[model samples]
Structure formats: C-alpha cells, structure tokens
Target: MRYPENWVNTKPGLDQVVKKLSSLTSLEFKLTDALIGDALILFEHKFRNIGDILINAFTIVTKRDILSICLRELLNPERTFNHYDLFEFVINVIDKPEEKILFQLEEYAIENPMMDVFQDNNGLIPQACTILKYPSIMYEYMLVKFGTKSRVTRYLMKEIITAHIGKAKLIKFYPSLASSVLMDFRWQELDYIFNTYCMAGVPFEPEFLPLVKTCPSDTVIKCLFDGYLSRLFGFKVEFTLSRVDQLPIFNIIPFTHREHNASSEANKEKVEWLNAINCNQYEPITDTFRRHLEKFRSRLRLNLI
Candidate 1:
C-alpha cells in the first residue's frame, strides 16, 4: 500500500520501490499486472540477474497468465540469463503445468543448442526427477513428454526409463529400483506411463517392446499383449532371426556351445597373436613403436627439433 516519495511523478522512484520490494523474498509481494510489468522491464534494463525475485513472485501470483508472461521474458532470445540459470528458474518456479508454457519450454529446449547439455544424466535426468516431485505438474509433464509420438519425446521417455532401470531390460527392471530422493514419486509417474497412458490407444512403438517386456505384472503384460504387443510377436521373431544371420557374434556363441568343441590350433595361434599386439600377453605395441620412433628420431636428430 505504501509508495516511495515522487512515485507518482518519476520513473526513478518507481524503480527504487520495485527493486527494494522484489529483493525481500520473505515479503509476499501481491504483484498486480502493472507492477509485475514494470518490475520485468526494470529487470530487462537495469537488473538482468533479478530472476530469483521474479521466479518467487510468479510462483505465488494468483493470475496463471502472469507465469506465462514470466516464461516469455525468460525465453526471450535476448534475455541475459544463461542456460543453467534459466534451467534453475524453470525448475524452481514452474509448479503448475500450463499447456502453452509446456509447449514453450519444449520448443525452446528443442531449438536452443545450449539446452542440449542439460538433457544428459547429470542434467535433465536429475532435473526431471525434481520436476516430477511436484504433484501438480507430474501427470501433465509425463503426458507432454512421454505420451507423445514426437521423436524427441520418445528419446526423453527412453532416457528416463534407462536412468531408472540402469539397464533397459524389463526383467531386471524391478530389482534395479534403489532408494533415492523422490523415487516413490518417480515410480508413480512411471506406473502411469506404463499402465494408463501406454494402454490407452497410443500406437505401439517397436522400441517399447523391450521396455514393456520388463514389466512383471501379468495384467499389465496381458493388456499390452492383447492390445498392442500381440502383432509384434511375429515381427520380433523375424527380426531376431534376421539379426542372428547378420551378426557373426551369434554364430560364435553357438560354436562355443557345441559339444566336444575346442579351440583349433590355428584359432589359438590367432588369439595369441591378437593378445600379443593388444599387450594383454606382452609389452604393448605402443612401447615398441615409441622405442623404434625414438631410435629413428635420434638417427635423424629430429628429437631436438
């Protein structure tokens, strides 16, 4: 309710008032549209790093559209915040999922080259875990990122599953669940993805077969099989048969398993020769090459050069 002296007359006084009030995180700044707009403009012109204040203010704002405005400013190409700072701002503030805001975030991430670094295990994986912790955003977030047909969405879904299961096998998937922060929340999200979303008429993805087979629930598998996976059974068989012929390693496995089979003398010699050069059975070839190169360089006096 209070205004600085000259607040009605000068921009400087408004700036001072906005700056002082936005800084106090403990104060519940009941930000109106005009004040919020003024504060953002000040941030653009004079205080580029006051993102924390804006983030906090947006989080508590009664108007949902205000959050969208904050996102628009943050995603502005000319905005001063770096990718890491932008990421923190998004994670800290985005408690609700507005479809438009989700689209903006996904689009910016797809288009901005700087955003790539955060998609890795140390980055988006953990950050996503944090995002899913919010009960409000979890379902919408999953539906947007994992329930889509987009190639990027598929990759993100795979990454999250891989991070949780460590290996992609559904059989080993349940055992891999170790205790960690917000993991129960993550499981709930995964349960939705695997159960409700996947079962709903989303066309079966071939890559999903591996992940689907990992589920131990008979009902889950039965629903998936009757609904989506039954057709893939033949495709799976044919694909595996095709790959076996294409990959020589498959042949080697059968050969190794054959009864009375032993390494042929020629194969043993070849193995020894490979090991010799590989340095598992002798001094590394790099050492010999280094010595030879040193001798030759000495003869040519190239070492001095």
Candidate 2:
C-alpha cells in the first residue's frame, strides 16, 4: 500500500513528519517510534515515491536507536516522572486528531507482519501487554491491526494474562472489569490465555478460579483444571492413563474380589454392550462418569496407578 499522496507531496513533508514524530513526548514516543520505523522501512525499500528528505528521516529513526531513546528518556529510573504518562502519549499518537498517520501506521503493521515494530528490547508481546494497562486506544489498535490468531497474538495473550495475575489486587477490586476485558476477545483463544497466564508459575488467585470454572467448553475446562493441577503438583504432568507409569502407584482396592467380582463383571459386560448400542442412553450416569474419572486418575501423578 502507498503512503497517502498528500503526505508525499507536502512541502518538506519528510521533515515535517520527522518533526511531528520528534515532538512526541513521554509514552507518545513509543507510538511515534513505531510509526517512524514503519515509514523508514517502507522508504528504505523504495516502496513508493518517498522523497530524499523522508529517506534521511528514516535513517535517523532506526529501530534499536529509538528503543534506546525510549528506555533512557521515559523508562529510566532517574526520570522521576510517572512513566505511565509515556503510555498515554503513545496512545494519543495513534488515536489523535490526525487520522492520516493512524491509518498509515495501521497499514504498515498489516504489510510488515515480520517487523517487531510494537515490541521492546525483550519483545513486542510483553511490552504491548504492559501498555494495555493504560486503557489507551493503542490496546485495541494493536489487537486489531495484528492478526489475533497469529503467534504474536498468543504471545501477547500470555503476557497480558501474566501481567494481570501479577497485579492481583486490581483484579480483586474490579472482577467484572477483568472479566469484561477477557470476554471482549474471541472464546477460541481462551486456551492460550489460560495456559499462558495461569500456568506460568504465578500463584493462583482464589478470585480467578471462578472464571476458569465457568468456561463453556470441556476443552477449556480441562485446560483450566490442568493448570490448577500443575500448580498443585508443583510441576507439569500428563494426566492421561498411558502416562500413569510416570506417577507413584497406589494399589488400594476398594472392594475384595469375592465381595463383588461376579456382580461387577456381569454389570461391566452389560454396560459395555449398552454403550455400544445407544451411546447416549445411560441411566444414573454412574458408569460413564466412573470411566472418565478412571481415565483422569490414570493420567495423574498420584499414588493411584
């Protein structure tokens, strides 16, 4: 996609754009840096009718260099300012009065899928999650501009969940708010959200347990339970029967063979045949439930084998 024609032809347009970018203070610098980088990369590749002025500006706005400036200026401990202001500034640059620049940045993010434009030194995923706390337009901007099903989305979801769990007090104060934010995203992504946030060695917050319990899908419920179980076990374990050999074996029998063997064997054969005929017509649901429980138990690293 081409840069807007008006942006290309304006007098000293590139300089004007750079000046506009440099004028960004605090968190706004992050957004400006991202946009500037996109512009620079496009100009460098000679993608469109970019002028010499713009080309020079692109050179000055190298990705690493801009990030360094951000770390030094806004994120530095010596700055004595609420660094959140930087977040606000970044949000404004994207959603500010000028629609042209915002559109250009959006287009750039789409065109350059491989560019780590929104990330920090560690990565864009974590940084974006941190910025999401600011309640800025950039949160939505980043989510929508980047394909939400992409690996980046999974990474971002993980980081966002991590950050949220790190600040448990916020979740406690506004449980509905947290839930609403999570609900805004597609449900298919819930597995990554749960695995990334809850299974990442963070302490389980009692308040968050309900969210997992209320999930509509058995798949997600399984994942949530797995995460909880992992935390409980202090390590990961595949709770499948085939993997039971890895766990401690327990040989406690609930009943003696003489007590129930004849009745149990007859009932088991009848139930198996019934299951084979009408898979959904089970009564009391005890057999089906017991079977699944046994399967789950077999997968657990418990004293039952």
Candidate 3:
C-alpha cells in the first residue's frame, strides 16, 4: 500500500491490483474498461519481472482476455519458466489450447535434471494428450522424446490406449491397442473391456476366460454368449429371445406369444443352438440362459393368456 513520492513516474504498483482482481469472483470481475485497463497495466509491468505472483493471478482469473494475455506472456521462449501448475491451468481453461504451450511445458519438464518428468506417472503431458485430442504429432514426438522401449513411452501408450477404450464404448475396437494394453496390464474395469470387445465382433479367445470367470453383470454375460455364437457361426447374431430379470436372454416369461412363420424357424434354431452350446467350455453361464429359455417356452406352451 506504500506509494513512493514519484510512484506515477516510477514503476506502476500493479501487483496489488492484480492480486485483488484474482480474488474477485467471475461475476464480480466485470470486463469493464477500468478493470481491463488495470489488467493491461498489470500485464505490462509484472509479466516478465514477477513470475510466482503473476502465475497465481493467472490461476485465479477466469476471464478469457486476461487468461489469453497471461498465456501469451508465459509462452515467451527466453523466459526461465517452470510453473507446471500455470501451464496446466492455461490449457484446462482455454478451449482447444495452443499446442505450443504444451510443447513449452514439455521442454521445461525435460530440461529439469533432477526429476524425470516423462517417466513420472504424475506428469502433465499424458493428461495434456487427452485434452488436445491426442494428436499423432504429439504422440510421435513423445515416443521419440522418451524412447519407445522406455517406461515413459509405455505410460504414454497406456494413456493413448485408455482414451481409445473410453471412446470405443460398445461399438468400436482398436485391435492393436487393445491387445497391447490388455496383454500387459490388468485393468480394473474388465467388464467394460469385455463388453466392448464382445459387441465389436471380436471372437472369443482363451484370454477372455478370466473375465467370463469373474461372472460380470447378466447383460455382460449376454454379450459374452452372443459373441461366442457369432464366433462359432461366423456371423453376427444377437439374442432377442426374451427378457428375464431385465437380462436380454430370459427373465420374466412373456405370458402369450403371437407366432410368426418367418421368425419362428429362426428363433427355434437360435433356441436349439443356445441349448446345444450350454455345455460348451466357452459358455460361462452354464445353463442359466437355456433354463430361462425353457421356462419361457413352457409358459408359452401353457397358453396362460
């Protein structure tokens, strides 16, 4: 709060101004000219000189223009910058953040001799890859920066594989990536991985036996059974037979059935196939599916309408 006699003529006291601005709520920090003027003055004075203080201000301020200004200033190549928090803050706040900023952060991380940032699980580049939509250039750059055989590259690939898995959901599969990650790491969400591969038409493999043994949710079991059938028959097929306990196969037996000539034969064959496969090693649910089907068929025969 101390003002020199010729404070106006000397370096402007903008640090306190920025500090106060940082504490104000988004709603309170209206983009009025007075505020922008003060921010611009702060930008000019404190940007290169005060690193820690301005970085803190950048973290708290949410306004795009101020953030933009701070980010531009931080990216100055010659500046001895090492604030990962500030780097992450800018990228997270801005939509589709500049690749250059991420590059700069990576450079700083690499230059630090004490810590192997790339190898560190807590490194920001992997997280940054998620935000930047995993550009191939960035991925390749990282691979070369940290040799492919290195633990760091494996970690980066893990991030890439995880991102692909999340995006795959049920319909898509990244075969190479899936194999690479699954063969090495034991993911906690085996059910999700199983369901994704099953629904994506990946044939049953012995490796999946452990997942089947885990006895995942009934819906996942249905996916497993359906996948096995598809692999066996060389054609994609879904069991739309009946719902039992909300499971696709059989749950509550429908009271009456309206018979259709075309689908009756197909349905019968599916049921027959389902029964035949009940004892197969690949069929993890034993006779649960067949038992439900039989129960439903019996209910239909009784004409309980």
Candidate 4:
C-alpha cells in the first residue's frame, strides 16, 4: 500500500497489525516477517521519510487491503491475548485416546439406555471452564448452571434450545440476559441460518415437514429424530457447516428456528469463518484440521473393527 505524499502527516498504524500476529511455526513467522519487510522496502521507495513503523489502520482503503491480505496469510491467529482460543482448543478431543470395552448383557440384564456421548461429565466444557484465559459466555453458563467443580450431563441439550430460540427470541423467555451476555456467542448457528434462510425463503424436503411441525421453543431436535423412513426413503442431503451457514458441497441437512432468531448481527455468518480451520483464509479446507480429522476417522475405524 502506497501512502500519498500528504499521508506522511498521518501516523503509521500498519506495524501494530504485524506485531499482533503470533506465528506458531518458523515458516509462518518468516513468511509474515518477509512480507512486512518487503512491503516496507516498497513503501520507502513509494513514500519518503514515513518512518519504519508499519501497522494496519482502517483509514486508507489500500492499506486496509494490504493488511487484509497479510493477516489472512498469517491464518489470523486468535487475538486471545488472555483468552482461550475456542476453535483451536475445542477440537483437542481428537488428541485424547479413546477408551473402549466390549460387553454383552445377559438375557435378563436390565437395559441402561443412557448414551455416553450425551454425558458432559467428561466433555469439553468442564476442562475448558478451568483453563480458558477469559471467562466466556459458555464458561459463565457452565458455572451458573453446572458449577465450577462439576458439570451437568445435559449441556448439549441446551444447544438445541439456543439453536432454536436464539438470543433475539430469548428476550421473551430470558429477557435481560438474552439482551446482554447471551447476545454474542453462537449457541448454534440456528439464529443466523433461520434468519438468512427464512428471509431468503429457502425450500426444504417434504420429509423435513415433521421437523417443522415438531419444532418448539427449545426445538432444533426434530430433524435428527426423524423416523428411519428418511433412511429408507432416498433424500438429497443439504449440508450445514455450522448453524448459520452451509458447506459449499451438498450438506446433510440444516437446522433452523424462527425465533431467538439472533446472533452475529455483526453482519457475520458461519460462512465467514476463515480463522477456525487453519489460519489460511484463502483455502477452503484447513490442512491442520484435516490431519486431525483423518486420525479421528482412523481411530473410529479401529473401534468399529
């Protein structure tokens, strides 16, 4: 980005942008440094006596564009500062070794229908609440609802609620908190997906009718509980990458709710995610996540065998 001859009077804000990037790998650090350095060399030739401090500021369109490209290339590491990087750390489950046991019940054994995935005693929330640098909404929710030392098993069930009710609709039931703390973080992308899609008036499969019918204030659950008729009956899948957005390719199905229809009204949607997968905003897939995902899949296969 070139500064006009008069901009020498303006402060150099670009350096702050570069300084903020904490490259995890040597390659990333070198690339980031090299790019900034090269940009400065060109800046010197292009602008006289601007001083060596370069940082990104929203003041100029060109500089903004350059900063955009530069930070994006850095994978735009989380500015967690003293906060936990949820996306980076959330998937840590892949690193954990899976424990398994094969057991057969006796003919007269009583049925214990509880599924383990539904249990939160060993879930991400408990561990996250303790270590996260900043107290987040989820952490706060955990503390108030489950307490610091222990966790409740039904945490994800609330996910279905938030996904359906959204922060906006929560104003009716939850009111103050909905208008406050519950406002920002996505409980599920339901708020966005419904607002965007409903506003757009997207169509759904006929079988999806049952989901619509069963949808409740805490509803985003109907779609998954559909009878195996959906399995027996062929249906094209609609992919949802997150609550608010869909994957580019065909997705399985998306969840939506009409109310609580709130979230990231920052004019952001799940589709805008660039920092989560890898740090590369340019690539559609995150290389790092793909590696972990493959390992998870391998572990799953071994368990199946």
Candidate 5:
C-alpha cells in the first residue's frame, strides 16, 4: 500500500497524539515507551507525524529516555525526511510560547552546534549559515543560550567560511562572511583569505596589510602583489624570473661606515640591497631607487586613510 504523500504535514493529527501522550502522568513511562515504538514504526513508513508528536510531547513533559530516543531518531541519517523539515519542526518548537521547549531546543543547538541535520553536500556548514542568516534566531535562541561570541558560533563561522571558499561557486553566495574570514590573523590561511577578499571585491583595510606582511609564503606574497596591491591599489608590481647572469653578487659591508652620504649614489646601492632582501620590500624607497623603479616612481598611496 502506498503511504499518504502529506503524512508528514499532519500537524492536527500529531497535536492529538501529543495531547494523548501528555495526559499519561500516572503511566508516563509506559506511554513514552509505547510512543517511542510507534515513532520508530512511523519513521520507517517515512511519516514524520509520530516523530513530531513525540518531540512535542517530550518538550512539554520532560522525559530523559523519550528525549534521547527522539534525538537519536532525529539524527539518524537513514531517516527519510529532509533537514529543512526537521529544522522547521525545531524552529516551531523554539518559537512556541512554552519556555521549557524553547530552552530544550536552545540547549540542543548548543550541544550539537554542528549537527548533521542537513543533506547538503557541504554538510553542517550550510545549516549553520542558515541559522546565522536569521540573526534573530541567533540572538534569541543561540546567543542567549550559548553566550555572545561563543566558541560554537566562531567554529561554525570558520567551518562555513572554509567550506564556502572550498567550493569556488559558493563563495559568491556568502560575500560578507568571506570578507570577515579574510580578516583572521592566522598566517597560514592568509592567501586563501586574501584571494577571497579580492574575488569578492571587498574594500581593503590598512589593518590587513600588517597581517599580510607577517607571512613568508611566496604564494601569499604573489597574491598580495598580483591580486590585491597591484590591481586594487593600482600599483605596477610584478614578479618575473630574474636571469642567472643578472643576479647580483653579495658584498659585505662594515657595521659602521663613517661619512654616510644620504644624498650620494653609494646610498642608492645600499637602498637597492635593502629592498632586494628586506621583509619590508613592499615599502617605498627614497629618490634614487624610486627613479629607477617604474612602480615606486609614483609614490605608494594608502587606499585607507
């Protein structure tokens, strides 16, 4: 026999079941066990009605065994229902006037912040971002329950941003999150962050430059040069393979040289040496070195005041 296509949307029927389940104060354990068995049977039939009934009843009247059974069933990957429906049911419970149910949902989101409720190829990241999309959902349920700027929220944000960037196509969907992730100080992820920032056309901040300066990766440097500083700031910096014959030989100099001529050609050679090897090569040099370099000839400009 074919099951009813709208079996999952039978809220009225579920509400009746919830009422029956709630009235079992004397025989609560027996009723709950029976409900659990019925819920499992309904779930196997792909009818979420019994599950909804059990969840609503458990939320109103707390029973550890029943709640655990419902949660285990909710999290089961083999369940026929999709995450959107499950999320809707949870949200409905959260929105109810009853504080106990809302509190339970809040506690659940905190404990299982990265729950595998969704079937997206991206896993929990999308569901996390969806929760974040509704800041009211975050502010009302998550923030109060988990506290502001909690580790769970931060972790979810990190995962979402990483997963979003991993799929090049999805980056455009979350431009603001992408930009925020780029501002992180962790040196290793800088290039990915920098490239995402450039791709999103997000405004550059002066704070970012100092962070990028700390990274030693050549790829990070090249990204800074080609992706951001060169085009965005309109600088003419380019990386090219220097010929073996053109490479300069190193010459040692005394630590202290007397009669240092700040305006002499000898000073230009010293500036060149510093620019060639100094970590701050990106910084502009004085007149003589500036004259020979096409890019630095035009004094470097700061995009942010």
Candidate 6:
C-alpha cells in the first residue's frame, strides 16, 4: 500500500490510485468500501471526476460480492443489501446530470415512460437484438421495471415468435418455454437506452438523460401502478435477487409514497388491446396510446388489500 506525494504529479497519481482501487474485487465488501473510501480521500479535493471513480468502484462490487455478503449475512444475521440499497448507492455516486445505471433512464420513467419505447412494428427489435445479446437480461429488467404483472414479455416475444423464432404450436410453447425465453430477452434495447456503443444497427442517441429529482425508488414504484396489476395473480411481493439482484416486488406496489390519482375512465378498447398482448400477440401495440390508461397511472392497484 502506497500513497502518491500530494505536492506533484497529481493527475497521473490519481489515475494510478483509481486504477488500483477499482480492481479490488477480491477484497471483503467492507474492506473494499473502506479502502476505496480512503483512496478517494487522498485525491478527493484534487480532481473533477472523482465521482466516476466511485461509480466504477461500486460497480465493481459485482454479483459475487453481493452474494457473498448476503450469504454471510444469512448465517450471521447482520443487515443485508437489497436492490434498493445498491440503486441508492449508485444514485449517491452520480454527480453529473447524465450518469446512470439504467440506459436513457429518462425514456423509461418520464419521456417514453415506463422505461418502454414503442415501435409501430418490429423495427426496434432487430436493432435492440444487436446490442442485447441475451434473453435473461431483458427478463430481469422486466421484473425490475414493470414487475411480473407486465405483459411486455408476452408482447415482445409475440414479435420475435411471429418472425418465426420457431414453428412450435401455441398449445405447446406459448405458456412455458416461449414465455420464459421472451422474458429472458426483453432488455435487448440496452444500447439504445444507454447510448454507449456503436452497433451498425442501433441508432446511438448521445443525448443526455436528465436524472429526475425524485428518489429512484419512488419513480420505480410509481411506474408499477398501472392497470397491469389487475391482471396479476399474486398481489405484491419484494424484488427477487436470485442470480444478479433482480427486484422481485414485481407483483405489487407499496401504498406508502405512492403517487395516486383517480380511477381512470374504463376504456374497453384499450383493455381489449392489452388483453391481446397478454395472450402474446407481439404486435400487441396497434394503438400504443390506448395500450394503457395513462390518466391515473401509478395511482391504481389490483392488490385487494
């Protein structure tokens, strides 16, 4: 362990320290946090981009680190880290207006909203496929954003399956394997949202995503209060962290801090539209506007409690 001389060669020295600190994945969680915190203190006042270093350090606390901590806590019964804790930590580390864990985060919560961007057709799917190489990432995101109640997986897969992903019958594949496969690949538009890569297919939008002023959890909970909850079997649950910290509260929204509004006018046509997607019509979005009753969105709930 060494500290660079503070009197000179500050930038190079800072870089060296950050590089070393960021790669410390083998260390215990508390030690890693303490060491990184100490290292940053050495250069904290000397740099403009120290926050990025912090974000990188936190990101380095990978799945293995979190799991190790959780298993240890289960045996020891100390406080455990949840997705909310991790997300809040990420938010705390971000100083710039555009930094984020979610891609073009604005598009999901506020702009396109619900973290969904609609295409009249499958135009976005292929482009998304180029960047999102796995199905499971999308599945996890599906749980994260809209919860298990959301029909997005069913709809997204309708597009993929309609493109003839396979000729399996609806009776055989629709409910089980097909559903799971689509859930796995729902976040294929990762690059489009993040705008971090240069794939030939996806049009990279380098536009800045303004991080909302509200708590990220609040925004996330608000996004889940749609009419979709009505369609779910389980009322509500915590977010799951099975493999990589998946949020399991996919079935219900908390009454606390929820931004509620009046019950929206019952729009039969729109209800029917989502009903189609629920059945896996992939093109479930003929009338995207009416796909959801947005008037009192985040206000409604299907949980009978």
Best by TM-score: 1
Error of 1 at 66 (Å): 13
TM-score of candidate 6 on Cα atoms, chains taken together: 0.24
- In order, candidate lDDTs are 0.38, 0.35, 0.39, 0.29, 0.37, 0.30
Query: Which 10 successive residues of model 2 have the least lDDT summed?
Result: 241-250
Ranking by lDDT: 3, 1, 5, 2, 6, 4
In model 1, residue pairs whose N, Cα or C atoms come closer than 3 Å (at least 3 residues apart or on different chains), thus clashing, are 170-214
Clashing pairs in 3: 243-251, 244-250, 244-251, 245-251
> Stretches of candidate 3 above 4 Å error?
1-195, 210-216, 240-305
| Candidate 3 lDDT score at position 68 | 55
Whichever of 1 and 5 has more lDDT, that candidate is 1
lDDT of 5 by residue, 1-305 (tens): 12356754544454565566556654655545445545554554343345465566655665564544544444332343322333334434432323433343455443323322221223323423322222122222322233223433333333333322233212333445534442332212323333333343332333233333332234433444444345443455563322212212212121122344535633453344334434455653333233333343242434333
116, model 3: CA deviation in Å? 35
Which parts of model 6 are misplaced by more than 4 Å?
Answer: 1-53, 56-88, 91-138, 145-258, 265-305
Q: Model 6 Cα displacement at 87 (Å)?
A: 5.8
lDDT per residue, candidate 6, 184-301, as tens digits?
3443233122211111111111111111111122212122223123323222433221222323443222212223332332244335433533443232321222233342233233
* Candidate 5 worst ten-residue window by lDDT: 246-255
Candidate 2 lDDT, 128-242, residue by residue in tens:
2322322222223333333233233334444344343322322333344444454444222332333433343233333233232222234333433344444343335443211
Alpha carbon deviation, residue 222, candidate 3 (Å): 1.6
Per-residue alpha-carbon lDDT of model 3 for 59-84, expressed as tens digits? 44544555655555454433333223
**Best of the two (3, 4) by TM-score:** 4
Top candidate, metric lDDT = 3
When 1 and 4 are scored with TM-score, the better candidate is 1
Candidate 2 global TM-score: 0.25
